[model samples]
Target: MKKYLQIVDRHKASLGTRFVNNFIDTIILLIINFILSFISAVIYNVTFIHFFYFYNNGGFLWNVFMGSVFGFVYFFFWENFTDGRTPGKYITGTKVISTDGKKPTTRQIVSRSLYRLIPFEAFTFFGTDGWHDSMTDTRVINYKNYESERQLKDEINSIGVKETA
Candidate 1:
């Protein structure tokens, strides 16, 4: 409703905040990929020295594919488990919510994560929203600001109502 828009409009995450969230999450993902790659190499009889360099073009591409897969899973579970907050979102003070100003459903989280696997999806942020957000009808917001605004709205709404004791 009108009150919902007021809170969301004032606290929606900016592109810059989104960028920071992605940056932090990507770094964490990279570290995870590195560790996994090393473990895989060890299981396959490759020496640690070769870990720094993939042996073939396919290996490089495999890493990229796995990275995307892991990223999807990470986004999905983190959002669902933490009420729309990933480690990056938490660090950046942001949260994801449905367009109607409610917590996103499991389907929304899954769809949002899947859309991220699209090529060049990050580039969508150049406009009003990223594909993952727009396609899933979700928005990332400044968590503290959104919560405060929502609290104020709740208080205002209760002002003219009679209490039932």
Candidate 2:
């Protein structure tokens, strides 16, 4: 239907926009990680006697596990608490929503975050949607479209008109 197509077009974010959002988010996360690592190094140097044994005995597996945990927590908490908008989404004027154009449930948000762990998931955006979105039945939509939809509904209601869509 015309309405359905229009809604889909309005809600879908362009691939360029998605790429930019991801780039910005990655940069921000990297900066934060760098600062934390610097602080840890300074602390370790000051308390060398206490942490020398643990610090020298490094585990690659532990590092990977902690990285995954950090990524999960960062994405999950931001999207869940911010109405599906992370810092990157906020800056890019995009937000995650259910396929039906509503806020996604907590489970959907968590699934979307976890799906990011998929190897080469970034390439999945070359298709219709990213793996995270496709798997979770969610979409990252333009906030402008969402605001316009809300205004339209409000106007219709004020005039006592029922919208079919």
Candidate 3:
């Protein structure tokens, strides 16, 4: 596990991968919001006429605020259930892990999600460590590489020690 953590820390996702992750996640979140709005409209029997109006006439600040709240919910639930891989991260073959090389706790997920609300948080990805990652002591790693390496290591260690699973 320690060695796997080392691999994850060293194999942090690149800026391009991170960008793709962000783009994919944003689109997913938007879709989720739309679905929820549709459901609410159906419940009201409004047929979403007001929904379109809200999107078209909503204030910029109101949109931003709701987006942030939505983002928090989106990130928290996905990371928690998927063990740190959001839909975007899963598609990119990446995952969020603690800096110490363990699964993140609920607190860490909450902190990371909230930190994402920071203004221009995406810009922080330009640096080696993203703001949400650095603040929460987490990293987004290339899980494909990490998982393969971990499996290889386990195989080697089991040689002559135990029966292969």
* Comparison by lDDT, 1 against 2, better one: 1
- lDDT of all predictions, in order shown? 0.84, 0.79, 0.84
lDDT digits (tens) for residues 1-165 of candidate 1: 312454665678998899999999889888887787667666557454543345222466876786788999888889999999988899999999988888999999999999999999999999888999888878999989888878988999999899999
Which candidate has the top score in TM-score?
Answer: 1
lDDT of 3 at 157: 88
TM-scores for all candidates: the values are 0.85, 0.80, 0.80
Where model 2 places Cα greater than 4 Å from the true spot, the runs are 1-9, 49-63, 157-165
At residue 134, give the lDDT of candidate 3: 85
Candidate 1 RMSD to the real structure? 4.0
Using lDDT as the yardstick, the better of models 2 and 3 is 3
Q: List runs of model 1 lying over 4 Å from the truth.
A: 1-6, 46-58
Per-structure clash totals for the candidates: 0, 0, 0
Evaluated at residue 163, the lDDT of candidate 2 is 55
lDDT per residue, candidate 2, 1-165, as tens digits? 111324644678899999988998778777776676666677778877545434334477755665667778888998999998889999989998887767789999889889988769999999988999878878888989877986897787789666587
lDDT measured at residue 81 in model 2 versus the true structure, 0 to 100: 93
